[model samples]
Target: MSQRLVVGITGATGAAYGLRLLRRGRELGLETHLIVTPAGVLNVHHELGLDRKALEAETSFSHAPGDVGACVASGSFATAAMVVAPCSMKSLAAIAHGFGDNLLTRAADVTLKERRRLILMVRETPFNLAHLRNMTAATEMGAIVFPPLPAFYHRPQTIDELIAESIERVLELAGVAGAAPKAWTGL
Candidate 1:
C-alpha cells in the first residue's frame, strides 16, 4: 500500500502547489493529510484562483487548518514524510526551532524530530541573513529546504508548468516516485 504524506499550505504565494500535491498524491493511490493555515486560506484565493472553502468541500480529503489533533500531527501515525509546500518563512522558522503551535508547524516538527523526510518548499526571495540562517538550521536538523526556484530546462511556458516542476522536485526529494515531470531534454 502507498504511504500517507502530509502537505501543509502556508501564507506563501504558491498555493496551487499544495492543491496539486494533494490531488497528485491521491491519484497515485497515496492517502494525503492536508493542512491549510488561516493565512493559507487568504493566500490561496490571492495566488491560485481557487476558493479554499469550495475546493476543500470538493476535494478528496482534508482537515481544518488549525486542527491540532489531526493524524498528521503525530509521528506514530506512520507515513512516508511531510511536505510544507510554499513554506512561509514564519512556518520554516517555527519548524527550525521546534515550535508546534499549529498543525502545519507541528507536523513539520514531528517529521524532523522523528528523522523522517521533511521537505520544506521554503518561499521567500531576496532573503535576509536571518532567513538563510533559519533555512540552514532546518537543513542541519534533516529538513530538505527547497526554495521555489523555477527550472528553466523544462522550458515551462505557463505558470502551471513551472509550479508542477517545483512541486515534483519536492516530492521526488521526499522519495516519492513518478511525481516528477519528464526529464528536460532540449528539443
Candidate 2:
C-alpha cells in the first residue's frame, strides 16, 4: 500500500504527539508529509527542545506553512489521510470555516473536500461554546475531532506511554498501524 500521511503541527501544548507520530510513521515505512505552523515550531522547542531541522529529519517531506502550492495542499496528491496532531483552536476554527489561509489549513480543507480521513488532535482544555461549536462544525463537515485525553485503563506509568497511546489512537483513525505500546486486549 502507498502509505502517505499528511501531518500538521499547530501551536498546541501537546507537541510530543506530533513528534512521536512522525517518528512512528517513518518506522512504519509510511511517507510523512509534515507542515508546522510558526507557533508549532516554538512549542516544539519549548516542550520538546527540538527545532525545525529536527522535525524535518523525522518526516519524508516537510513543507513550509506558508507554501500554499505544496503538493499535500492538493487533493490530487494521493495521501491516505491528514492529521493535525496538537491541533490548535485557531487551526480548528479555520478548518471549521473552510478557510485556507495557509498550507496546513488548505491541506485540511482539501482532505475534507476529497472525502478522505481528517483527524484533529485538539489539545485545548475548558472548551467554550465557540470551541464546541467549531468542533461540531468540523465534525459536520467530516472531520474527526479527537482530544488527547489519556486512558488510564492502559496503566500508563510515564508521559511517553500516555503520548504513545494518543498517537496510536490517532493513527488508528487514519487507518494506519501505529506503535501502540499497550493495545487493549480485554475488558
Best by TM-score: 2
lDDT of 2 by residue, 13-119 (tens): 99999999999898888999999999999999999999999888999999999999999988889988999999999999999999999999999999999999999
TM-scores of all predicted structures: 0.91, 0.96
Model 1 lDDT at residue 40: 87
TM-score, prediction 2:
0.96
For candidate 1, list the clashing residue pairs, or say none: none
Candidate 2 regions exceeding 4 Å error are 178-183
Q: Number of backbone collisions per candidate, in order?
A: 0, 0
Output the worst ten-in-a-row residue range by lDDT, candidate 2: 176-185
